[model samples]
Target: ASAKARLIDVFDLSDVQATYILDMPLRRLTKFSRIELEKESGELTTTIEELTAILDDDGNLRQVVSDELAAVGQQHATPRRTLLLEANASPAKSAVPLEVDDAPCIVLMSSTGLLARSADTEFDASADIARAAHDVIVSSVPATARGEIGLVTSAGRVLRLSVLDLPALPSVIGIPALSAGAPIGAFVDLPANEQALCLTTLDETGCIALATARGTVKRVVADTPGSKDSWEVIRLEDGDRVVGAVRLDDAAARTAELVLVTSDGQLLRFPATAVRPQGRAAGGMAGINLASGASVIAFGAFTPTDDAMLITIAGTTAALPGIDTGSMKVTPFAEYPAKGRATGGVRCHRFRSGEDLLTLAWVGNGPVRACSSSGVPVPLPTELGKRDATGVPVAAPVSHVAGSL
Candidate 1:
């Protein structure tokens, strides 16, 4: 008890700590207690000395902090795998800021009145041999993506169109269907009685020959001057409407001939020299002589060549259009000799029983294509026929025939 009291006073120990020390087994205390105490004292002395030296020197303390921070940063930073770039001035590259490049493109129209434009670069023709639905382009006009074109209507009105506003077709194989385009009716504000006939350029370099249902032919003189977007190209008489129109190279028209086919199996061909250029407001002169109840069904002016072809479709007047599957004949334009202006040239097609009028007719340079009124493509006969021979029966009615430009 006296020893415990002395130890407690010297160590400043509590009663429980003093009792725990005094109660230790004597042999264990003498052996392990000295070794353990000496080792612990040595470690504490080294740690205290090192800490006191670092605290005394400010530079040592800062160095330690910096080493720690650098280690942490090295461990957390991300690495780069690619190089970066910025625009420069060494090589001058002009800025092409156009929303749509002013590239050359072709505007195409389908028989169903749809219109679309496709890029002319790498314009492919390999897929044209294979026939498909909506593959027929009834009319195509060349224009730039940023230029303007003119659309000819059956009512003799020519309306200007912005090329940029047209729907663009993807780079495609074969003739594009123009299914992506809006209906022509949506683009042009036309009367219900009128319809768009074909496409033409608004430029003044060439002339456009037009034929009316009332047997009139007129050449829309080049150089249409006006800021007006739309104007009358021909002064159509009452109940008269344009049946066909085609662009003509003025130099070529000197040798070209105007062909007029009537509904009653009459065809007229005369040198385009027979007609004179007329102002936009001038009424046309007589183009073909038609029997009573017969009207001009088709007309075009073409320079006579071996490639020129005449296509005719025969049907009855009583049958609703495209309902009666008509007969078709493909004949060389040379089969019938040319006649004088305003004279019925010759009988182009002899009608079979129940067929009274020529439902469709075309005379121009071909590779021509045909389609039903509903836009389904119809194949033509491989055999050429005599000028006055009957046409071979077609599986379905052909409503339109168009030649490639």
Candidate 2:
């Protein structure tokens, strides 16, 4: 009673509270709980001592922090994977060169509607390479790595494209494969039913000779205005479109002949001098006298000294295009004599049993490269047949053929 009175006096507690605290029963713990309780009590006592020492002096707090950091380093330290190096901080232009050196390259167009450039300028088309996708290069033009080239489209329009923006082909032996090239639509804003035909230079020294499906021929005067990126090279009729285009010079045209092959197996050959150069707005003159319902399929100029061979592939007119491989004939161009303009051409290929029209044709220097519609490499006849002979059935379907520059 006296001790309770002293506790109440020290804490200023009521007598009833002091009596309740004195009568409260203690909690009983199990064997496991007693050990846990003792552990918790020891941890709390140690924490309290450490905190009291930190409050007593600043050195104890620093020592605790240092011990914690050292524990963290021992627990989670790892070997370095990257090293820090010093570099000079300078202007961006000097730090990184943004200019491409002017090097000779070839701009190539695959038959599968792809465009790219390659640094393999000394490759020959006659040499064999691995048969990969887009193995056939239909058109190739010489250009610098940073120069510009022209893309001639079927709509008789030439679109200017920067060579630097073109995709570069990896260096390889023999002819380089252009499977990584971009599609023509990626760079040119082409319209529906119109596609790029070939490549040419945007210079003024040479002329652009082209032929239309309606037997029209014209040599466009290279009068490209300043800074003009696109221009119409020929004026077509209601249903006419350009089939082929080639760069020409006055010296080459004098000895060269413009050859046109119609779908009905008619081929007309005439000196390039017959068709004169005309302005862009002027409609072309008739270059061949076609039979009713016949249209020109191939038109190109070849020099007399060139080992030019006429390539014609005939397919069943009843079947869907590219569905059949058909037959191919390679006739030497020297066998065909020159004819006058506006005259019906001589028979170039005799039709087979089921063939009625030509599905593909080309007249240029051989040996040419052929590929299927799916960009697979195709083989051609190793023999040079007669001028008016029938072609043999090809081993595979050939959708396009190209001559090496």
Candidate 3:
């Protein structure tokens, strides 16, 4: 006790161990007490060395904290209240910026409203060998998987479809080999009895040329922003409906001419500027003066240097069902004089026997490909000719024509 008192005075005994020693009971101060104090002092010295080593070594200090935390966690662990899944650990609704493949793809739409995507725009196969039973492939347009496609309806409405949303198809196989495609209604809402007329890609800034069966035409700005899935393109008369709609790029809208084809083989070519641009709801000006029974079947835009292909599908009547005997001929746009709007245009294709009606026409700057009902490629005229000539018969019955190939 005396030695401890002297030691406490000599050394600054401010530590916990020194305090306990200094406060020892007076009755336990015996020789045995001295032995006990020595043993405890030795033990305390060992503990001090271990703690000092732990403080000096960062790895050992970290281990001590980890072990203590683990012990506490094990003793107080609780079950999670929320369900967790390995497949969807993160609650992400969609990719940031929507990672869409920008590779080029071909958008195919059948007359029955089935839609599919293919990598090759020039893909060709027989209709019997390519398409499903009773399905007619009507339109195929080349677009990137990231581009927007416009599904123009006979009701004169436009439905926008993202190519990324379209089901991807095998490039080598025909349409019949794949599953029956989704309907147009799957992507856009449509009114009862409303059917799609054509599939076209939208331009960044341009106008949409719309032509109706009653010979009315309108040009609506293509870039008009809207949140709705579909938009009004033209106002139809009581008995008339939109037969065709095409998107004209800024270049095409400025310099291209509009070509309107009739069931009676009348072809009207006029500058796109001839008719002023109209609003979406405006009833359009006259594009052609249809005869009593004749109606417009196709409308397209082309530049003067571009060669246009007019396809006349032979049938008993001017309808898809009557498209049996078909002929496709290419004509230079310079050959056909640009007539005034609402005028009766000159003849573009002379009627072959059994084919007095024209089924479809396609106008663009690039090479055009015509196909039979079965999707097989039909040969186009090797030699370009003047306007208003009889077209050569296709190798098989033709049903559709695709331009800008």
| Number of the top-ranking candidate, with TM-score as the measure | 2
The model with the greater lDDT, 1 or 2, is 2
Give one digit per residue, the lDDT tens place, for model 1 in 1-405.
Answer: 998998899999999999998899898788888999999999999999999998999999999889999999999973331222335526566688758988998888778787778885444444545665555666677889998888988989889888888888777665566556767766778888888888887777778888999799998787655698888989988899999887777687788889999898888899888999888989989988778999998988889777789999899879886588878899999998888888766999998988888988998877777888767788889999998999999978887777655
Each model's lDDT comes to 0.82, 0.84, 0.71
Candidate 2's clash total is 0
In candidate 2, what are the lDDT values of residues 192-237, reduced to their tens digit? 8997888988767677889999999998887776688898988889
Give a tens-digit lDDT track for model 3, residues 163-194: 88777766554333223466677788788867
Which 10-residue window of candidate 3 scores lowest in summed lDDT? 126-135
Query: Can you give the lDDT of residue 284 in candidate 3?
Result: 89
- Model 3 global lDDT (CA atoms, 0 to 1): 0.71
- What overall lDDT, based on C-alpha atoms, would model 2 receive against the true structure? 0.84
Q: Where does candidate 2 stray beyond 4 Å?
A: 1-98, 304-306
Supply the TM-score for candidate 3.
0.59
- Rank by lDDT (best first): 2, 1, 3
**Model 1: how far residue 347 lies from native, Å:** 0.5
